[model samples]
Target: MGLTVMMFTALGLCWGSNFIYMKLAADFTSPAQMTLLRVCCGFVPLVLVAWWRGALKRAQLRLLPHFLVMALLATAFYYFAIAKGTERLPSAVAGVLGGTIALFTTLASLVFLRSQRPSTAMLWGVLLGFAGVVVLIAPWQDGAAPLDKQGVFWMLGAAALFGGSYVYVCRFLAPHGLPALALVTWQMGLALVLLLLVTDTSGMGELLVHPRALAGVTFGLGFLGTGMAFLLYYALLERLGAVASAAATYLTPAVALVIGWANGEVVGPRELAAAGVILLGIALMQQGRDRSKVR
Candidate 1:
């Protein structure tokens, strides 16, 4: 249990800090290029790790189509949206908004997932979480800097795609008994290919000349955030189980807020209050939940 707790905390820290990495890299590259580079650089480690674990050898080629779709929804669209959104939003705000994926996931389940029904708590959680999102956006706030509507919309779209992808994973992929590493390996591989086609590489020469941007893309976003973070999250999902593993989402906002503050980003009271409300909603979503459903 202690190890589980530690892993869970580590997962939150890793994923939470990913927004900072994205923030660092976004300014240097186009969204498509940034996401492409992230997946491409991260791909090496994931492939090696999957091979080391014999996941590649054990994978079923029959599920390639599903993996392709998962790549589109989860990795391709997910990271692209985040990269574009991070360019326009504060890192902490993006991170807080990212956690709202859970709320979207629960709502999505109630619709497309036939076997799933909304619990009273989940319904309330959804409403409360939406309220928190509205407060976080605070469109009516008269201040020096209002929230970026474009950024908010992009992140919300990312969260929604993320939630829907998870539902597809729960319903389709998990039943196939594919190793998580193997799945991610293929997903990233496919995403890398697609991104390469759509992405402009004209900035590559300039980015190579800038060491900070290069390192941010190769090491910060690639290895630690994308490659290792996926491994850590999957480990937590296995050890803590899905519902409890979600505690990471609750813990991430604090990490993001602190990191963003240290990096000279503004952390206002309104943002903090919104995070608290979102946390409350997440807690309610998990309240007395059974293990029968995928989170």
Candidate 2:
């Protein structure tokens, strides 16, 4: 098959597997520690690529204010929050909830992004996306093995941050015309520093004692999920448009569900159905995205 196809498939696998990786490593590290390690490891490959390409500009320092915020929204907060959620919820469930990023982005765009108005289908997509979340959660049930509330909070918050970061970048950073690789490198670097400042490093080596845990962090969470996934995404964007290339919002959850099932997690039909609904909504939003206007 084509290189883009291979990269797209690999990237999806990496992102989908990330939830289970976090779940695996959750036994050994705090969410903070996990985020710290993921960012630290991921940053290495990114900076190297940026250096090789000479994408890192000295003048980009003028945009440090925006980069710092992007660091929080896109890197630090998003990763930490997902780790926190995955620590509590079943990996598949966390993955399903992740589909809401598109929903949040669509809504956030309508509100904050006047330049890009939503089409009729996009509004319907917002409604259906939320309805799918409700099905996923089923809050009305009286303790019928309902999903963890706190975990849902973290996952949804992460989804919102991930989704809204698009708008944030479009408004604040995209206008700068900095190299995408360079911007990502700086954003991740700042996030690494921010995470390092607040995250305690004690007991982090505990993963070394557990082979599975160490593999989860070193392979699945950091190198593949964080670092290599970013590079693959950039490659996909080169091959396909953003709307066509970005599939993790819905794709990873399916992989996560399959992997979760293989791991003996109880993924019933209800979760599968909810995931279907969310995916449908996301597809519509993507199809309906108003691309005529440039931010």
Candidate 3:
């Protein structure tokens, strides 16, 4: 459990830092190019790891459709929408919005999956979390970016799809004895093909000209953000249980805020306050789960 908490913490830090890296790369890369490169880079190491572990041979042929759907929802749609959204919003704002994934996942689990209905405490926790996000983004604030309604919508769409994909994975795939690494590898590999189908090679050509941008893409996509972080995340979830694992979502925004500040992004007192509230809300929700277990 202790190790799991540490892994969750590290995953939050790495994923939060991904926003800064994406911001840097976005300067030199279009959304399509960025998604294509990131997915490609992420796929390579996963493939190597799966092969090294002898898991490649165990992959189910019939599960190809499931893997393809996972890739489309989790990688292709999620990353493409997020990259495009981050181009318009600040990294800090993007992080805050991304943090809402847990909230959406909980709601979706209840409504669509019919897994568990949230208790009164859980309901309050959800509301508080949503309020915190609104405060952090402050879409109504004067002098803030015009909110980029389209970008916000896209990010939310990505979050919903990602949440749904997770549900599918837990319900169907896990029971079939799919190892996490193998599943992730197959998903990313399929996503690579799907992305290539739509990506503009001309935009990729423009991105390769900038060494720093290329390095950022390589680091964020290949190692720090996706490859290592996801491996740790699955391990942590296995050890710590989902509630503790989910705490990573709350911590990610704080990490991103620090990274954004270091990158000279403007952050206000209100944002800080909002982050605090969001953390409190996440705590409430997590603790509510504990209470449920006890009951």
Which candidate ranks first by TM-score, i.e. highest?
2
> Tens-digit lDDT track for model 1 on 122-232?
778888988989988988877568888999999999999988887898888888777787889999989998888888898677787778878877787888778887887
Residue 185 of candidate 3: its Cα lDDT?
A: 87
TM-score of each: 0.92, 0.96, 0.91
Candidate 2 C-alpha lDDT tens digits along 139-228: 888848878899999999998988789898889888988878888999999999999888889998898889998878876788888889
Pairs with steric clashes in candidate 1 = none
Model 2 misplaced regions, further than 4 Å: 290-295
Pairs in steric clash, model 2: none
Q: How well does candidate 3 match the true structure in TM-score terms?
A: 0.91
Candidate number that wins on TM-score, 1 or 3: 1
Identify the runs in model 1 with alpha carbons over 4 angstroms from their true place: 57-59, 291-295
Total backbone clashes of candidate 1, pairs 3 or more residues apart or in separate chains: 0
After TM-score superposition, the amount by which residue 19's alpha carbon in candidate 3 deviates from its true location, in angstroms, is 0.6
Lowest-sum lDDT 10-residue window in model 3: 108-117
lDDT of 3 at 179: 79
